[model samples]
Structures are given as structure tokens and as C-alpha cells.
Target: MSQDRDEASAGPQPAEPERGGGAATSSGPTDDDGALAPGAIPEDEVAPRSKSRWAFARELTVIVVIALVLSFLVKTFLAQPFFIPSASMESTLDIGDRIIVSKFTPQHSPLHRGDIVVFEDPKTWGSVPQHRSLLKRVVNDSLVFVGILPGGGDHVVKRIIGMPGDHVVCSLACSTKAGPLTVNGVPITEPYIDKGSVPSTTPFNITVPADKVWVMGDNRNDSADSRFHDGTSHGKLGSVPMSDITGQVVAIAWPISRIHAMKDYSNVFAKVPKP
Candidate 1:
């Protein structure tokens, strides 16, 4: 019996389990499954996250506005879109081709012969027939003013054939084969013109007036250019004033398959004497 009592008191036998099936732990912030309790987020961190999001949005808005303003300014002063509307330019430029005309080049340098140029239609020249209604016209013009569209009313594109004081003449019988088109007593070979198209169908002889330029389309048969207005006043109809020039077309940008630089014909006109 004394031995049994010694074994019973040996180091403190395992304590009886708590009243529950398993031993209970000290109470604290925990679920029955032992997951931690949710704590309140700091007010400082919450406000900063919200403010940061708003700040990012504001910065994005500022950047977008700046980009649009820069684009408008560049289109207005440096270069702008130009679209070919008719077949007058033919093999050189096709209808629906988009081009970029450089306003800066014409501003700094004198206009040269053989340069494809965009100009304002002279008052006496016939207006390009527009099939749109009045409302459509107004909307189109508004878009152009805001730098959205390429061209507006009263704008025409042609190749420069004569400058001030140039004496230009063409065959009376519609024959480029018969050595047509002479400028300042020098014959001009226009390889840009379409095959089978004569230099001119009607007779014409004119000396470009002072401070003016004579322009013609490559598709001579279809073009109503300086050749059509020969019977009118010297400076008023047959020639465009230097101030009327908008820009020189440097490149065709649209229709990815047809992308190309508008070639300058300086070599073709090299032998012609300046008038």
C-alpha cells in the first residue's frame, strides 16, 4: 500500500481533462476554428488609397487633354491631311488616296514648277459640284475647321505648270504626240500624264501674270484648269495668285498598298527657262 501511494503522487499524475471532451484554451480573439478576428483598417491608409485613385484619374485626364491640343496645333500649323477627291490627278494621285501637305515648306520657300500643290479656287473658277445637302455641307465645313477632315470648300489640287511671266502654249489639235506644251519657248516632256491623254484638247497661249501661277491637272482631258479659263482676265481666271497656294503635297499616306512619296518633277522642268 505504501508503494502504491508513492506511484500515485509520482510527479503529479496527468491532470483530469477539462469538463469538455478536449481541453479548453484561454479565451481570446479567435473563432471556434482558431481563425484570427477581423481588425479595423487604419483611417489614414483608407483615405490615402481613395485619394491616390482620384489623383491618378486626374493626371490621366490632364495628359489626354494635352495630347489633343498638341495634335490640333500641329495639324493647323505644320502639316494637315489632304484627300484626293477626283481623277484629275490620275496616275499620279488616285481618288480616295490620303496625303499630307506640308504648310511649313511653302511658307519658307518659293513655290517651284512641277510641285503638286493645293490652292484656293479662284473666284472666277467653277466650283466643284457638291452633291450634299446644305446641312451636310455645314457639318463638313465645321469638322474641317476643327481639324477633323482633310479638305474644305474652295480648295483644289493641281500641278504647277507655269509661274509669273511664263509664256505657255499647247497643241490646238489635241495631240501630245505632235510635240505639245511649250513653256517659255522650251518644250516640256510630261511623263506624269496618263497614257493616250493629250497635253491639251483646246488651243491656248498665255503669259502668266505677275505674282501668279498657272496650274494644270495630269489628266488633261478631264481637268478644267488654267486651260479652261484662258479666255478670262489675265490674273483673275487663268492663273492663281501666290497667296492662294495652301501647301505642297509631299506624300500619300493612306491605302497602305499605295503608300508613296509624291515625286518632284524638277528634272523634267530643269531645261525650261525662268520667266
Candidate 2:
């Protein structure tokens, strides 16, 4: 009776829980405070972070590729950027000025007489070929191809003075004593010509042929334009083929102070009758 009373005082022993199937396993290694230890995250948890990083990288790549393609398409068919390398079109487009040319003008829109055009070198036009290291050329070409850099060297920009079938004439002694440039027998007043410059120092009379145009620069005295190339060795290299035109200068794109839409001077050519 005493022993039974003592056992009752000691209280009953606790039952042992079953192992294996019913056992509770820890999710991962833990520190003293029961928080997951550094680098002790489960493989499944870590995999998601890795996958997210890869996904981000892939998405960025896709976006960059898409942007490049759009830029190329815009440059190819919509518009392109160019920088003035010389003073040929100065006062209007100074050296180091950047401009945007619209391909739509040549492709879809009717080109007007006063339009400023960009075209390939019709007869080399006295442009000296630049010598560049192969690596430099590759880098520059790639940038130009992608529309990230403005095109230069192989193209020239000038104002169209005579379109197809126009009888253009610049009178004798093309110096300070030069005569007014007449188109279709009408003298056109040009207010865009550079200060202290004459119409031209070289005189010529030529009727622009079909699918060709006579172009001149705003800086008349400094420009070696259609007049200089009028009677080249290649014969009448002054007239640029319409097919060679890349586009028309639509706006000045750089030199924030000079940012403005290009003027076509339609009124200047308004009175000149079409041939």
C-alpha cells in the first residue's frame, strides 16, 4: 500500500512518440534562434532565385534586340541621322552640326525645287577618302549600320536648285561681279546664301535632264558644287541622279542651340515656272 501510494506521488511516465512516417523533419539547418543559417536554404528555394536572374537576363536581351531592329528599320526606311563634316552648307548647317534626313521625302513625297537633299557622291565630288585602321572602321561601320552613329564621308548634302527638265543658268564672270542665278529664265532671290558670298564664281548653263537634279550649297564661295563638276571628265557629272538621293534634310538634330526644322524656301522658287 505504501509502495502504491509512493508510485502515485511520482506520477505516471509519458508515452514515447512513433518514429519514421509520423516523425517531424526540419525544413533546413537553423541557427540558435531557429532561423535558417547562412547558405542553408533548401535547393528548391535557391533554384527559384537563380531562375529569376536568368529570366531577367533573357528579357533584357530580347528588349535590346528588339530596340536595335526597330532602330535599323527606322534608319533604313523612315529617317537617318548625319553630321556636317565641312563648311559646304555653313550658316545654314555649320560644321559639326547634326541633322536628320527623312527617307520618306525621296520614297513617298514629291521632291520640291528648294529641298535640301542628301545623296551619294555622284562623281567623288572632290571628297578625299579617309584612311582608318581596320578595327576603327569595323567599329564605326557597326555603329553606323545599327543607327547608333550618324553616317558620314560617303554622302553629301546640298540644296536642289534645278529639278528635272529645268533650264538653269548662271551668267558670265562668276565672281564678285556675278549675275543673279536664274532658273527657267527667272531670277530667284536667295536669302540663305552665306554673308559676303556671291551666287557662284563659276558660270554654267545647263538644262537639268530627266531623273537628275542640279544641287548647290548655301555657302556658295566655299562650296565646290554642281558648277565645279558641270563639265567634268565624266561629262555632265554636275547633275545628280534622282535614284542616288538618300533623303531630304528635315531638321537639325544636334547642337541644341541650332535645333530647328529645315526650311525648303518654297517661296524663293515659287515664281520660277516649271519647264
Candidate number of the best TM-score: 2
Error of 2 at 81 (Å): 0.7
Candidate 1 residue lDDT tens string, 1-275: 99999998889668564565332343334468855334423334445677889999999999977876776787778888878888888988889999888887578878888999998888667666668899989988766765678884578889999988898877664353577688898989899997678888776778898888999999988887887875746434779888888888999999999898888799988999877
- Write down the TM-score of every candidate: 0.76, 0.81
> How many backbone clashes are present in model 1?
0
The TM-score of candidate 1 is 0.76
Write out the backbone clash pairs for model 2: none
Off by over 4 Å in 1: 1-39, 47-61, 128-139, 173-176, 232-236
Which lDDT value does model 1 have at 14?
81
In the order shown, the candidates' Cα RMSDs to the true structure are 9.6, 7.8
Clash pairs detected, candidate 1 = none
